[model samples]
Target: MTALSELNDDVVRSMSIGAVFSDFDGKINCLDFHRTADLLVTSSDDDSVRFYDIATARLVKTTYHKKHGADRICFTHHPSSIICSSKHNPDSNGEFLRYLSMYDNRCLRYFKGHKERVVSLCMSPVNDGFMSGSLDHTVRMWDLRVNACQGIMHLQGRPTVAYDQQGLVFAASMEGGVIKLFDSRSYDKGPFDTFLVGGDTAEICDIKFSNDGKSMLLTTTNNTVYLLDAYHGEKKCGFSMDTSPTATIEATFTPDGQYVLSGSGDGNLHAWNISDEPNKVGSWDSYIGVVSCLRWAPRRVMFAAAAASVLTFWIPNDAKSEPGAPNPEG
Candidate 1:
């Protein structure tokens, strides 16, 4: 197997959109790839959840939540299940965090605790547990086998929660540009480490840990992305470009941690090389609306980007070439 550090820049530059799926009636809110399968799931404002087979580039199933509608979604350890936040029955009030079985479109569990909309949801990398950050200023943890919230933490700001690749540490980004790191095994003791970023005016939209669990990435509504040392909470780098004041650009690190990617309101996707000086390396125009969601496939040399109602999958032009091989067209 080729080491990720050995990935050729030419291969990275050769990436191009290979497939486009346009079926959503509304904007795509989130996209997640199954860790162990060539499958992906997306939630949209259209109140639906759709699954696709990445290998076949085919839409496999579509499920609807007509009442409140689905928003953020993450696939669980089980291939046939997913957890999403959606509205509850109108009469009951508030929203519900649902664990749904894709095999039969049944909601196997409902973790109903968030008093407001859940803006962030992430499944634990090593177990059937998951965590969610909500506008209600709380982070709630849940176990798939149970219907109740296992733990909860109140935050001073709207929270964005994520578990590291090893599931040993979980980070929570909250108001006032504060990020608190907690030991997953004993989070109730309070965060063991904390770091601050941005300013009072900045709103953190997302937080993600690198695949190797060595670093973390934070995306802000201020159109800036920060790379931080996961072990010590030290800032590594910050990425940004000229963007609209209203743009909520979401950024992500490549699966190999060699590059960082973000979607801009200017209808383009941007990538930066992170190994050396962080510099803009590539940009692709989607020609659609604001590219809101961007995700690299966990186990392949491909990624998927969504903007408005369009979804596009990108792959290296010579993806099948052997490692260390020169590009024929170059």
Candidate 2:
């Protein structure tokens, strides 16, 4: 099916959990999709990583890291290799990230730098460069070719980092609602522009750029998500979710960048239209618990949400096929 078929408000509203995977024993901490493949990867508190073939709608493989444990995982440029944080395991020394080859179940390399647990991790859309934001109040940059950190930025409060669609720039959101934009090549020189969100004054849960790189998305612990102009840093709008004191509900922009969706404290998946004025467009049924993680496929007509031990995929019931389909950033 063409991705545009699923982007319609009615199609989005018609979406419901079409598939459910309950193999996880503990909460799923992170999940990512292969950049140009129909594969999905997820890591959970159960100390396991699972891979799925989204094109076939089947679980492909499962690997365990019982010793070091797995959390905050993402695929490197290569689908067989993944980089993951190992802070949940007591045996692991603090702040060591693992580059693992899941095909053979081997540790490829260890990336060490952060003094505290990493709360956020993302790969650059255009290259091998990746970033990790830590509770240590620092954001570190790395490349797949290097085991050592390439660069790091210190900031106050909890830090979340994200790169624009082109990977030409990266943005960092911190406590006190401060957001700084840095040129990818010379971030060390300091942010070229900074925007103060004014009043959030809380730990940031996530930050993201729209597929077109025209807007920025920020979610905070105070249960608010803000949409902003990427070029001028003007607030386009803000959406309030349920009061979620315990979970970090992530908000993701649709692949077309016309709408945004998030998990809420009430256990439902909520969506809003942010292209002009912000309005609640739809709120799907409860996802069993607070949906701590939600992602839209970067090129597909699908999305997924995880809460507690269940991972559910959403799709329109009558989605029709075309010659090609674009996906979302799951």
Please list the Cα RMSD from the true structure of every candidate, rounded to 1 decimal place. 3.9, 3.2
Q: Tens digits of per-residue lDDT for model 1 on 22-104? A: 87898788999998998999999889899988765677899999976888899998887999888445235444788899999
RMSD in Å for model 2: 3.2
Clashes in model 1: which pairs? none
Per-model tally of clashing residue pairs: 0, 13
Query: Which candidate should be chosen as best, given TM-score against the real structure?
Result: 2
Q: Which one is best on lDDT?
A: 2
lDDT of 2 by residue, 1-330 (tens): 535644777877877765688879888988888877888899999999999877646778899898878878888889888999984653334545888998999998888877778888888888889999998898999988888789988899899888898889999988889989999989989999998887667677788899889999999897788888999999888777887666778888888898899887887888887767787788887556898888887668788788878887777766423222222232
Looking at candidate 2, what is the lDDT of residue 255? 84
TM of each candidate vs. truth: 0.91, 0.93
Candidate 2 ranges beyond 4 A from true positions: 90-95, 320-330
lDDT, model 2, position 167: 89
